[model samples]
Target: MENRRSRRAAAAAVALITALLTLVGALTAPAAAAPPPLPYVHGGQTVPTYSYADAVRESVQVDTHLDSDHDGKPDTVAVDVVRPRTTTRVPVIMEASPYYSCCGRGNESQVKTYDQHGTILSMPLAYDNYFVPRGYAFVAVDLVGTNRSTGCGDVGGPAEIGSVEAVIDWLNGRGTARYRDGRTASPGWTTGRVGMIGKSWDGTLANGVAATGVPGLKTIVPVSGISSWYDYMRLDGVPRATDYPGWLASAVNGRPAGTCDAVQSDLNTAGDDATGDYNDFWAARDYVRDASKVRASVLIAHGLNDQNVFARNFSRWWDALAAHHVPRKLWLHQEGHTDPFDIDRGAWMTMLHRWFDYWLQGIHNGVMSGPKVRVERAPRQWQQQADYPAPGARPVRLGLGAGDGGAGTIDTGRGSGTVTLTDNPNLTETQAVGDPNTARADRAAFLATAFSGTTHLSGTPTVTLRFRSDKPDTELTAKLVDYGTAARDDYLANDLSGIENLATRSCWGESTADDSACYLDTTEIVRTTDYGVLSRGWTDAAHHTGLTRYTPVTPGRWYSITIRLQPQDQLLAAGHHLGLVLSLSDEENTTPSGTGANVTVDLTHSTLSLPVAGATHLGTATTAPRLTGTAPAAPATRSTPTRLLP
Candidate 1:
């Protein structure tokens, strides 16, 4: 019996030893890594952990009609894309720009990067660096005729719009896309939804594309974009400063001048340099005229004082969108020709992120439920409202006269007077206000009595002059100014002038090995104890008959012309005065008409009307006591502005 029990114990011990050996093997052996989460859901706030280094980097060449190189085959537009490493399909955010190849983008001017074999490594502007990890594809397209593309840059013409449309078509499997080596590129990983965004010229492309009613485009965000190329170059059928179309085409084409000499010549002639009338060239590029074709939702941002693209571009576009009942929002600021990212990065990013997530991912995050318009109250102060131009703004006419209470008199009463001013090419805006004690023949000045309380001007103002010109055609310019004693933000002069020392450099968002991005975060300097030109407007007296057709004025015939100033949203402080400065020409910015003429105004029937936000009646107070306020700081060293290429 003892021998049988010992044999059974030995068998049990062998089983225990086998179990221990299996456990040891499992621990020592390397385990397989877990698979990535599948089927990424849209509108999810949690960012996925995808390796950016392993992200897909590629370029696609789409076909276009522009034979920029004069090759037999159709020219190609280069589209460089950076997307997530995952296989899940996602929407795209594209920026089609001519400046990508030459001037670059942002404050530091970063250009596209390529390898030795001409493979694109990265595109400009850190959009990919931020959105790729969030399951989005960032596409930087080289406008036809620029960079590695094979077309003559038309500077916002058919080639520009058609080339970008091809890319959207290719993504949706309606067109073709090929790699640099001529191999077919399959865009099966994209969800066929695209949102085009850009600032300045880039933004102008967005406006043009949206106006085409492209299928795949879901939305557009045009910052400081132009609605009409003609407006950018001319105002009221008159050249603003230079021959913009020909000059811009040459500026973007960085190749040998001989390569595009033919195109440039065509531009010069087609531009109608002799007569500043609207022709086929300007008609084809007017997006506002084609606003009916815009199906995609829009979110436009522009500075109120942007002289480069001007506020008229956005205001006119907004009016069209409203008429069409298109979904749209606006972010109007006080800075001049600047990006919101540089002014308020945190808020801009938050709003932009939410905007994309809602539009692209179909996230119902209440973005559409929010206010449709947000306007800048001051330099950095912002306010939200239901609509723009404040809702119920009306006009109040201020008559001009030649007597003591006449010049600078802005009231409802009509007065009789005759004032003559000649063209002065050398007259500065400061001098255009005219000496209060003396009369100047070079300009005419009319000032309103000091305000007794705060007043906001929220809409466009008009100056109707019943005057007779001594010449066949005359150049008339008018400026609206806020003459106050306290310090105010000089948004005009400080926009491109703020110099940031590297000592003040700061980083924005997550950084990667490929792109180490840092931006200048600083407040724009303010100029104290000065006058701010609220708005400026100009018109060719000949265009009053009709913008398209010129009606040469018979010399000495009295003609009534209405010049509309750029719209504004500004507060006139207590005791501050409003100045209406009229001159024959603006030497600093306007074209020299060379046709010297004396403009005589008949004050009896002429008036300047201002649209004050809430005033039902025009109030005049000459003895209003000045409100007390602290003095503004002295001007600092003028900072160099980081010029952005359009």
Candidate 2:
């Protein structure tokens, strides 16, 4: 009887202890959602189970300088966001642009739209529809002075950079935003990691913001973007395209016509188009100058034939990034002022997807491995390389021989002679390059032996000329052309509209009711030509001293200077001849020199060194043709003979 009573007491005590432990466990359990996965890699690829209609849509008013309305507070930058409806936080992809509310984005010009209840129905491009479903937030910011933001559109000024920084701060819970009813909001759903991507002006903002060394920004993809505002508006101490600052400002600022006049006036005064040299104003806009501040990895895509945002912009930026030891990638194509979406759609999307996923999602996807550069060897034909200015690109000098009449020989022998050309402001590049025999008195041509095998020009060519000018300042233009009988890619003329027929339309990524993920995959158009310009360089003899200062030339003294043409990656077939043309002015691209100077070239001291890939022997002369006269010659019926080197 005593043992039974003791056993019952022990059992009751144990049961009581178990009940107490269960109650304590229930009370101490976590009330918040589970933490994100460690090394968030594999999960980043899994599509999130979330409804687009139920996704969170919000806006933030980031504080910036220069309140155009005389408001007591600084101007507010409008940040529109769309993200998956998930309890767990996710990374963000943002694009800051002055065109979000206006001219739209990409070839189709898609803009942002809002629903009846003030919820965002769609965002520009297909980034939101595609990435939001893959567990990332999409933020679109309307640059100051455009859209709902307040302030003057200071084209790439402090206000623009500040607005971007503020938005980033807010995303990381360091700043503030408000709802329509005045309720405060925060990026509560964001993981604080960010990636920026865009094209043209939008990409320019990416370059600017990344240069700021903003804390949360992890990577940037600037496609066809400018690194220096001065490079865009001017070229080597000469105004580039006319009405640059004024026209560009007007195009970006969609506010009342005169609302941002004060800002416009400031831009005009600072740009100082008459004198094309670096100043304090341009210094403020130069992201390349501030590249040391960049902490984010960079991926740059640019077209070699892009006239708007020249490839030099990206090349310079790439050099700076490499110098700073920042992680970088490049996609140099053979198109003009275009997005990679139309060039190689599938590959572009894949690369971008992997890029963002690896950077933002902590994915160890080996994206940084493999080649760092993808160069277009031919139209839409890409070749991967470990680095740019491709390895083994040795400088091959084509020595200029004495002038035989208006024409000259480009060979290994140093011969004596001089060729003089008068400066004509109205003379066009077409007139100078069409037919060598028809070249005007304003230009001089030098011919090189044809290639025996396929040859590649992989980098910038330096034109070292020993010349004398008749005036204090004169403009000189150098063109490298591939003289051949074939159809040349007319990159500048072909439009991106692809096939206009509806049947040819196809979707990429995901689509929404307001915006289609579809685009027309257009075929590139080609034009037959006797010669195609491979590369070009321009300089003002005065600016040759330095881009920041002008040095006048002596009328009759010989001056030796090197003009480095824009970087290029062109392939010449076996029959193609390498032709070098020197002219007084490049009226087609820049403002006319109008200096009326007669430029004379001293042939013996001049040499052209091109970065030719896989060159063995210097080309041998197979044909010695007579030089064209001062007057235009009759149109030729057959192709001219071109020599080759083995």
Candidate 3:
């Protein structure tokens, strides 16, 4: 009898195994929601980062406390400041942008306070990597609710501000550590100067800390930063409806289990509106509104063709600083957000060194002597400006007619559109065979599509869209395309709509499957910026159909808008073509979405504001220099300054 029962159990086990195997086989394809497991060895600890000569090894990650109101449930914050082998105590420029380090660490998790440390990147190449080896104390702080951080994550609010001040105090108060004695192991800043550097979220925080107007904050580099969240993720002051829900979910879910209770909808556009009266909550956070409060010398970098965040964000910051007569410099490129580190590492390192020396080392390299601005004149060539966005440039309007709108520019308007892609939202192009990786991938369809007859239009393109929606609120997105790539075209970029891929660690982190939208620094580029829907790994096509599009009825109710698809400062030489497509909604990375409009998207007042780089100094920028004969490679070993460690 016992043997019979055992046989029955064994039979059941075999049946279950068979079922699971069948299921897995049926789904052998990629798991859309699954992310790769964390790697055994971190990519860091081997490569040198900006702030360290060797991989840093501290005895234990320290946990700091942010007791803002002194309630027993202390607001938990954690930071590790690696002072290295310095001669004396050092002043610190702390910018905790939560750059992907604290994600998987397991330390101590608590109610109001938590502390963890799993987020190490392709090495400690995050911001801390840049600060640690430069003889300054490099610290990565988890404010309130990230990693094993304690309290509730305030989402870059007052909590971050308080925690930042707290960490500064903690460093100042610590007498010694196992690695170095604070009093004896620091030369500190020779000038007692503290500075901040970061891009994107970190960049925003980098500027935010300065708003407190803290003393000793000598300089700030807000790379790809914006003045306001509304401006960054919304269009016309409307939080992106399609992408906001997923965005809020991604950030909140990153917090410890119980610290945050807000569901995805809680922070959706509706939820945000329910909580606030107007865009007031967003106004207080705008950088321009508080630009006057910042006293640090600033260097602003932006990409002119940045589809993510419009140049308007950086313009606001630059404009505000100019109004206040604040000392600032600007750098513009024609790529996506931050300059791609993997590909543009060498140039970035050079840029970093020049910046740090001018600010930290007090070197007289005449670093800020010129306009201190740089714009990519053309392929592999960049030009300097005393003030960014040089003065010779002005907007020249071009129009398209109701004809075959191939690559040329013509006068356009007085026409109407009735069709809508409330359903179809896939991009128009994909990379051609044998050249899929190039920028030509997005223009899979046409060099020019005829709306009427073939109209010979000239110059760069801009679309002046006069649109209205049925919904009370809406967002309008436009993508400018130039079909056909030369054998060696180097100026195209894959602009990602940040609306979709909000989560999917597979895209943001080191997952097995790769994504295209997340990283968009294609060749023939200059600079980049960040903006709406917010970016992570946007590529989910399903969610795109969730958009709510409206139609226009009344006259003058339309939102008359003009979008600069191509940079005005260029010479359109011959058949190197351009095209513009309108979308009430475009795809996001993981948060893929589409337009739902049945309205008329009249190209009524649309025209290209082309800044023709005619035959002269500006026109010279049109030349795309070919990679010449082989250049000699450096020796196997080379020496870089300690500050340039990463």
Candidate 4:
């Protein structure tokens, strides 16, 4: 009996010890790491599982190295942020812009709204509303000298770029910022990954900031942005407008009057509108020269008919990015100075969501495994291609041959003769190309025979002329026109970026009483015209030597000048003719020199280079016979201006 009781006690003690050990192990074994809060992805995209209506909103002031206003203090820019309510870190999408207070942003011209305590209540566009619910933060920054920021606007100068760079630095925890309540603001909620996006001036800032090779910027989407300020205001040393930089600075400056007057004066003096030359002032704002420093992936969007920013801005930047083998994608549409969201809302949103997911959140969404270029051939008609300049495009050179009257021929073989045309500053492009078959004294016209099949022109065109001017200096204009009756986007209209806003509204994400995610629906403007201008170029005769140097023209001295037209992608159907018109002082596009100098061209020395895709030659050229007495008057049509923006 004693042995049995001792064994039973011993077994009970062992069971008790085993239960205690198991309990201790359960208590100490590092509670199954609460699955780090992360963005949820499904169907190859980040899902909108977070609540947009309850996102946290805040504001901060970032310090910049520049004192553009001469206030003896460093400038500080305002940044408005919206993020998910979670405690975990998230990636950022920033838009640095000067138009927040001056011109507003997006299609509806929505500006930033603030509360009584100076906190941001609403952002300009739908970016915050759409992205915040998807576990991303949206930052709307006011460029220095605009809105609530302190400084003077310098256009695209160093001060502007410095302001944007400072914000990026702060987001990366490399710089300093302060809240409105004077508390130090730290970006502890961010993962230090950022993507910049905007349109117009906002997009321009993206290009500028990305060129700086900032540490945290992972990618950028520049929509209708300028690559070079010199190209924006001038073309090959020809001024587009006088006092443009100063005027633009004054227009966008939101500070007190007279505070930035000195800055405006400096802009006028440094821009050198009188000389129309590329100087140090322009070199500082040229982004193409610094493209090699870009470390971020770029997705560029531009309108093929964008006259305000122009197509060359994107093309030159695209070429520079290609030379460096940078990761890039392109979206080209038929609208003018517009956003892809306004063109194709559903597709743009999908691509943008997937793009951010892949680049910012490190999601394996396969966004980069497709064709690199998407172009809209017509209204609402899109086509994807491997690359631009259409894969197999090659330059086809044609020599100009003088014919009867002012009519001329462009063919493969050179012809011997001289053609003369007197400059008329008052003549418009419409008047110059009117009744092109008959020709006019104010302009010289060259024609190529109708295409036998569909032909594509996918790149920039160059016009080389060997001419002698009667005066010391003169201005010249070259235009490539497509002669056909087809329906096309009417990009020259004065409406909102070639889109008509409808009464019906569409919502993208969650909405609040003060800030709604709904926006007015839009439709593209279309017109069926008899002829359309494919590309236009202008130059000052004195700039024949180089863009930086201006040599006075010697009377009767032959000068060979080359004018490169804007980039284009067009499909010429069967029976469509291509024409080149040469005139002086394009009244529709440039500031007329009013020199009225007569120019004589040597037909044998002049040539036209066209980028034709999949074509060995342009078939043949035939000069139209001289008209009898009076050529038939051109049909009355609406005038199309080359530029529609101020």
lDDT per residue for candidate 3 within 446-511, as digits (tens), equals 112222221222223445645554443333444444323322112223222111122222111111
Clashes of 1: 6
Q: What is the lDDT of residue 247 in candidate 2?
A: 62
- TM-score leader: 4
TM-score of 4: 0.91
Clashing residue pairs in candidate 1 are: 68-151, 68-152, 145-151, 408-446, 408-447, 496-641
Instruction: Report the Cα lDDT for residue 311, model 3.
Output: 61
Q: lDDT by residue for model 1 over 413-455, one digit each (tens)?
A: 6745778878776676656653442457787767666677888
Candidate 1, residue 349: lDDT? 74
Give the residue spans of candidate 2 off by over 4 A. Answer: 1-48, 65-72, 116-118, 437-439, 494-503, 620-646
| Sequence-dependent TM-score of model 1 | 0.88
Candidate 4's residue-wise lDDT over 487-582, tens digit each?
A: 778776644267788898888777887789999888898877666778888888989988887787999999999998999887877766677889
Instruction: Give all TM-scores, in the order shown.
Output: 0.88, 0.87, 0.60, 0.91
lDDT of each: 0.76, 0.76, 0.42, 0.84
Task: Give lDDT for model 1.
Answer: 0.76
What does the lDDT read for residue 645 in candidate 4? 33
Choose 1 or 4, whichever is better by lDDT.
4
Error of 2 at 541 (Å): 1.9
Quote the positional error of residue 301 for candidate 4 in Å: 0.6
